[model samples]
Structures are given as C-alpha cells and as structure tokens.
Target: MQHHRGRTRIVGALSVVVATLAATLVPTVAANAITGADFDPGHIISDLQFYDNAAMSEAEIQSFLEARVAPTGCVTSNCLAAFKMDTFTRAADRNICTEYTGGSQESAARIIYKVQRACGISARVLLVTLQKEQSLLTATAPTSWQMTASMGYGCPDTAPCDAQFYGFYNQVYKAAWQFKRYSTPDPWGTYQPGNRYIQYNPNPDCGGSWVNIRNNATAALYNYTPYQPNAASLANLYGSGGSCGAHGNRNFWTYYHGWFGDPEYGGLPGVTVTRFDVANRYESSTRISQEAFPSAPVPVVYLATGHNYPDALTAGAAAARQGGPLLLIDGASIRPVVDAELKRLRPQRIVVVGGPESVPESVVQALSAYSPSVTRVGGADRYEVSRSLALTMNPQGPVNEVFVATGSNYPDALGAGMAAGYRKVPIVLVPGTDTALDAATADFIRRLAPQKITIVGGPVSVSPGVEAQLKTFAATTRVNGANRYEVSTNLARNLYATQRPTTVYLATGLTYPDALAGSVLAARKSAALLVSHPYCIHPSTLSAITDFKVNSVTLLGGPVSLAANVKYMVRCW
Candidate 1:
C-alpha cells in the first residue's frame, strides 16, 4: 500500500528537511548514470538484485546506517543506527523465505541480516525502502508512528496502520515475507514478468500504461506497490510531482539507483562457469595458481607485483617453463593470504621478477622463509626486465623459437605468453609505438638467433619496420587478427595446429591482471588463453572453443571482470 502526496503515498517524494542527508547516500564517484526518465516501471530490479543476501554483511549494514544517520545530529535513540530489539526465530518457507534464526536483543542491522538471509532479499533493498517509505534512514526525531509504519507494509492509503505489524522488526520481517511471496509460484496473478497495465494512482480516472516486467523480482515490486508513476513523477524524481503522479515506484527507482548501483540486469542469466576468484586481483591470481598446481613442493614459484602488469605475463611464461605457479603481491609487504599460498606451494626456489621498485628488498627478504633459494631477475624498465627475464629463461645460444609483442598494451601479447611457455622459449617485449625495433631488443634477437620468429598482434601492436628488422635476423612471421580476441584465437590456432587442445583459459580483455597471471596456467595445461569481453566471449573465441574441442574453460576473474553471462553463452558459439 502506497501513500502518494496527500494520500498515504511516498511522503518523502516531496522535499523536506532531510535533503542534505539524502544526498550522502549517493557516492559522488559511484554516481549512477541512470536518470529518472530511464526508470522502467515493469523491471524495477533483477532477481540477483533482490536475492543476493551476501551483498552486505551485518557490519556493512550497520556502517551504512551509521553513515546515513549521524549520531551528533540525531535527537532520538530510536533511529535505525541506534535501535535494538529482541528478535525471534522464523521457520523456512520455500514459497516465501527460509527460516530466520533470530536471537535476543538484536540490533537493527542484525534483524535486517536475519530477514535478508532467511527471505533471500538484499539488505540494500531493505535499507532503501526504509529511507523511501518513511525517511527513517535520516530521521532525527521520528515519532512512534514512523517506526510503526516503518516499511509501510500494512499501511494502505484507504486505511490506518495495522497494529499487528507495529514494531520495526515486525515490519521488516513481514515486508520481506510479502515481497518473497510475490515471487513464488502463481505469484500475484495479475503481475508476472510481461506486459501489464498498472495504474498511476488509486483514482480510477488516473488510468494505466503497459510495462513489460523483466523478472520475478520486478514482478514482486509491482505487486507490492500496485501503482506506477505518471510522467510528471519521472520528470521530477528527486522532488514532488504533478496532480495525477504517484511517487512510490518512482522513489523506489531513484533510491535504489542512488544508494545501490543500477539494479537492472540487462544481460542474460549466469552460465555455469568456474570463476577462479577471491577478494581482489592478488587473491584471484593465487586462486588460479592453486587450481593449476593443487599441491606444491614440486619446483619453483614466480613472484611479481599485482599492481605492475608489464612483467607479470613474462613471469607467467617463465614460471610455466619451470613448471611453477605465478603469484601476484603488493610488492611492499606479503599478504597473509599470499603467505598462506606460499606456505602451501612450498617452492624449492622463489624467483622475484622486476626491479626493487616493483618487488623491493623487504618483500624478497620476507619471501626467503617460504623457499630455500630465492633469486631476483630484473633490469631498468619492463622492456629490460622482459629481456633479462627472457635471457634468464634460456642462458644458452640457439634459442629454438622467439615471440615478440607490444609492451604498451596487454591483450595482443596475452596469447603469445602461453605460446612462448609451450615451446619453453622467451617472449620479448618492445615499445609498440616505435617505428623500428630498439637496439637492446635487436641485440637480444641477434644473440638468440632464433630459427623461427612469430610476432603476435596486428601491425598496430608490432610495427612493419620492427617485423622487417626481425626478418633480417631470422624467418619472421606474424600471428594476428583485427582485435585482441581474434589475435588470441589466431595464436591458439597456431599453437594447436595439428591437435585439439583439451583445456582453455578465458579472461576479460577489458583488463589485463587476470590474463597476465592466467597465461602461465593455460600454458602449463597446454590450453588456449582467449581474451573475451566482460559480458560475452568473442565470436573468434567461441569458434576456437569448437575448433580446439575444449572440454573445460576456467574464467579468470570474478563476475565484475568477466560476467557469468559470458560463461552461459560460451557453449552457444
């Protein structure tokens, strides 16, 4: 039941004293691009948006409330930030929410967590609803009535507040239950995820418009509110609206966008993809490394800074040649998680790539505890580092094969890293923008005197002059395509020319960290490392999947880096 304007609508839709407080909820840097005009009445949010209970922990929820309701300005101890209540247990309901195991003297955050976990609704949604429905989020001195109708669960425009759902805990629980109920089988019969004519207001004359609801969660939102905002409401979302306007649904969109991110899942559902991820890039590297080398003590481990990308791929290549894992770090100190991984790997020797600036002496000294022999291989910059690393990889002359790629960017060079490792050769780096090969790389190429030279990437990545310079030294050729994804497929296609590879590593082309580290794992497994769009695998990558007869694909990063949607469509192509 919504209280619009003078009716029991979304009261805060009109500007009040809490405007300053409302602004703080939307972070400036995280400012959502969606505007009021972009509001979709049918698809209010996604199933993932509504059901991701892990979106916020109890501590995070408490912090959010504390940030919203500043204690010094608060006149009432009854604010959500300071409020606490004894909570009870709830039984599991498949159609609605799971059983909530409540406890005595529960804080607002705790109660919210229980309800969120049990009902499988995001606590973020619960927080936004509190702010939208009653401004309870920033309420300095709310009346007993405000908390009573906290979520406006049983408060309809035509009737007074229901006494049974009076308290904050009760309101939160019942509201979560009701929303979950709407998502169940045979949901509110009138509203499913399709076209539906929802009214603008309680007034019969207000009429309705057709909205194609996206999912069950969206359907649940419509069934709960039962009214759509008129054009006037969308025109001025932050404030009040026209005569026939309803702000319940409008405020829902604005609050959600401002507080959380865009709740819309414009993409498809998640495909079953094995995401080798933890908290961040460093952990993701370790997770991927662990997957490649389940147990350790076999040989050596390559250490590189997760912050610096230039040396990571070469390090991965070198590590693969030695049959080891490439681990990423902060360069300054060893993370407890990294330390744990090192202790598990129990490498005979740890090789630190890059100069002191990249992996300083302190980190090297600290790393000595994990391995008996620790060595450092680096030079002035990434180009020198790559040269020195390549030389270190093969100290002897007559280096059988050589691969060259741009140091300026990562994607084109990503597939080359695995190819170099597969042949146990060095992958050298040169500045891509340069017209010709630099003296150091030329001298290194002369020293190696390779039988075959394969320049990975298009002319943009490796210049024609550089290719010509390489041809002077040996039989130089190129494996390239229009884009990073195509280049990746071309390199993989060249590697497994005679046989189909069994494994493939899929990493996001939008970023380089995961691909940089995953390259080694792919090489170790004799698999292809394909660059992909965050949301979907490229056409070339899909074709490569089929051509190579890849039975497994390990997605390198988390959902944000490479969306699960891409994983679902991998089999399609």
Candidate 2:
C-alpha cells in the first residue's frame, strides 16, 4: 500500500443549548451523538463481528478507543461527566449479548452519541450502520450477517437488509464532512441536516422503512447535546476518532492521504510531489563527458635534420622525400657533395642545415646560384636555411616526406636524423665528408636504408664505410659550420619568415638545452629546435623554458650533454 499523509478538517464553535442537552444525556443518550455523515454505522457493525466472535475483548476495545481519542479541552465537571457518559454509552452498544439482540444496536447508538458530542454530527450522518448489523461481543452462532461483516459489509438482521461496507478511515472522513454540512446551516442545530440524509431501506416503498432505520441509526449514533460548533474541535475529532483516528494511533495515517482522498482537504497534488522527489534523486547520481575535437581534416607535420645538415636536413626530410608533394630542405651548403647525392637519390627538397656562422657569403652565393629557392629563415643573429626544391612546404601542416643532406666531415648528421624521427619525422641519413666517391662511403650507403640504425661516435668519427652506406640514402648533401646559437636563431627566423617545414640544429659544442629553451621561449612560433646538448641546463629550467609548445624541442647529443639530455627528454615527453 502506498502510504501518504491525508488532509484535515476543522470544527466550529458549539452553542450553549447543544452543550446543555449533551451534558443531560449521560451514558444512554451520548451514543446517539452525531460526528459526521460517512461514519458508516453499518460497516462498524460488520467489523465488530470479529470482536463479537471473541476475536477481540472488551479491554482491547477500550484500549483502541483510548488510543484513538484526541484530548478535549473541555474542563467543566459537567462536560467531563458528559464525556464519560458518552464513552460508557458507546461501550454498552458495542457489548450487547443474547439478552439483548438489540444490544449491539445500543452500542452503535452510543458510538454515534460520543462522536456527535465530541465531533458534532449524528451517527447516521457518520454512516455508522454496522452497529445495527452486528453485536460488539462474540456471537455463539454463525450467521450470514457475520460472513457479510467479514467481507467489509454490515448487513442488518432483518429482511431486505443489504450489506454496506466502508473502510474505517474513509468513514471517519465522511463523518467529519457530514458534521460540517450539518453545522453550517444553523451552527447550533441539533437536528440532522435533511440535505445530507441517505435512504438505506431496500424496501423504500414500505413507508420509507429505510428512512426510519437511518433515523434510528442516526439517533443511536449522535445523542450528544450540541453547543458552540468549533471547526478546531471538529478537526481534532476527525483526526483523533474512528478509523482514521485508529490508524493515526498506529502511526500509519498521515495528512497527505486525507488531502487527496477528500476534495475538501488541502495539499499539493500527490503525483506532482512524488515526481519532484524522484527527479531530485536522479540528478544526484549522474555526470557527463566531453570530446577533445569537434571538427576534422587538419594537417599535422613533423620536421627533422641530418648529421652534417642537422636542422635543415631533418626539416627537409620530414617535408619531402619521406612523404609526398610537400617540400623539405637541408640548409647545409656542400653543394657538390649535396648536389651529387641529390642527383643520385633525388630528394624533393633541400634545406641547408648549419650554425649561425655556417651560411658563409660564398656558400650563400653558391646556393643562390644553384638553388635560389633556398630561403634564409629565423632571427637575424641566428638563422637556418630552407631550400624549396619544388613546392612550398607549410610547417603547420602534417609532414609526409623527408629529404637528407650528408657528408663524411660532419658526424652530427646521424644524430640530427635520429632526432628528426623522434619528432615523428622520418628521414634518410647520407654519408660523405666531401664530394668524393669512395668504397667506405659505399658501406655507409648500405647502412642507411629502411629507417633504423645506430651511428657510434668517436674521435675523427666520419667512418668512410658508414659514409658509403649513407650515400645509398642521401637525397642531398651539404656542409657548413656555425655556432649552435646562430643555427638555432637562423632556423627560428627562417621558419617565421617562410612559414615552412624547417629545423635548426645547434653546433655540437656550443648548443645547450638551457640556451635552446630560452630561444624557444622567445620565439613562440611553430619553429622546431634541434639542440645537440639538452642537458646544459637543469630540468626545472628547461621545463619552464619549453613549457609551451614542448613538442617542437628535439634533443641531439653533445659530448658532456648526453646523460642529462637523455634524462630530461625521456622524462619530459
């Protein structure tokens, strides 16, 4: 059963005459007092069948009554006496035996009396018909009436007696309303209201026998004296007496139920209240997730540099030969060396990788002559070179191809190539210290294939055999020397100026992670820096310098910078 709080009704003031009449009636008259119309005397009589069958004792009845009654504020001895009389009168009606077939009827009468005295309507008005049908005490013989009572209907002992059943709480509410309808017309009226009467006789044609039964039922229930009719008193009566009162004693009845059950009762609609509570519970239990990208089809590119042309070769290789139509360049200027390699391997772009001082006037002049498309990019003091062999490469887009410039004289190219791959840019490393063709270079040529390889460094480390293996892969070969800072700065300037896939490799000895981090910080664009020694600075300092756009910082090895650079790069990424 879905439990809910029910509504409440208020009683009005009582008149002096009614109070006087109620006071004179004592035990015999009190049982007939009116409480309300819906009290169902017939149902009461029926329910009492269980009590009559010895199922419930007198003590239990008294206890039930006491538990259900609300305390009345009436302090006068007369009022107290009247109240006691009414209680006894109802008890007697409920306790009728064989010596009194009508005893149960008397008990029904007394109940109505107390209800009317205490609540203000006759028992008939309260619908207490059960009192007429069954005795309050146990019956020795089983009867159809008892069966009907058990089924919630109170059937009178006489012919044409039909069963009438009403739940206990529902009766109380009906009784309260009956009292209200009766009281409103003449606030002090002792007579039952004609408008609220019900004809219960099956043979209504028999001079309205049902009306007499109803009248007698009314008299038996509400025998109380009427006084000032108070709505508060009535509310207390309805809230405290009858089935609602009994349920209240059991702690089951609540105000919400009454409000919805009774049209006159007050409260918000039941369904709405329930829904509000459910919604609150749902909101408390759930959460939501969000996606990183809402749009699509944007390009992402990575650039790398070669050993000799550390920065340029890496960038060029990333942009051209490794991918597609995009351009890559190697900035190193060993043109004869790079051109021969370029002719043999044919990289899509050539970026001359070098330090700040590496771009000499002569080399620049040669580049101007050979590939005027080669553009100087980055800051004035430190710039790298971007040689667009063909199509212009956009640094911001995704990288697909790679180009490489190699030479035997510069062992840095191998490190540059590895660094490029770390940046997700694929590359080819070329070998040759000069523009010469040698078997050693040929061996280097053999080693530079399908991507992965290790180039061990040593004093005077350009292994000719390694150069030969590198030649097999060298798309372009360039040679030049410049300070690490100049190379980095030039790379940054050129990247900003041309906005192409570019790389700047710092010269071995001069490049420091700290200085490179600082340059990166200063140039907040998309330029990639290839620092040979990332360990020259503390990890914390490097962290702060490369905090933004950290993806652009690539580490190359320096003699003293190896361990720290390795540690920082491994952890930071």
Candidate with top lDDT is 1
What TM-score quantifies how close candidate 1 is to the native fold? 0.62
Show the lowest summed lDDT stretch of 10 residues, model 2: 284-293
Q: Which stretches in model 1 have alpha-carbon errors above 4 Å?
A: 1-49, 52-270, 273-277, 391-401, 409-415, 418-425, 446-451, 458-460, 474-512, 524-573
Q: After aligning candidate 1 to the native by TM-score, how far in Å is the CA of 275 from where it should be?
A: 4.9
Candidate 2: regions farther than 4 A off: 1-404, 407-431, 435-479, 483-492, 498-526, 537-573
* Candidate 2 local Cα displacement, residue 3, angstroms: 57
Question: What would the per-residue lDDT of candidate 1 be over residues 10-75, giving only the tens digit for each residue?
Answer: 333344422443465564123346666788776787776676654566776888788776645567
Residue 371 displacement (Å), model 1? 1.8
Q: What is the C-alpha local distance difference test score of candidate 2?
A: 0.27
Residue-level lDDT tens digits of model 2 in 1-573: 111112111112111212222222212111223444433322211111111122112232333223322243223322211222212222222112111111222232243333433333322223212221221111222244332342122212122323233333223323333333333433322334232332221223311111222232232222121111122223443332222121111110111112111111111122110000011111111100001111222122122122223334334233322331111223344424334323333333334434445444455455443332444432221112322211133334334333233433233443333333333344333333334334432342333332333232321333455444444554323222353323333333333443442322222334322221212212222334434433233333233224322323332322233322132232222
In candidate 1, list every pair of residues with a backbone clash: 3-8, 3-9, 3-10, 4-9, 92-99
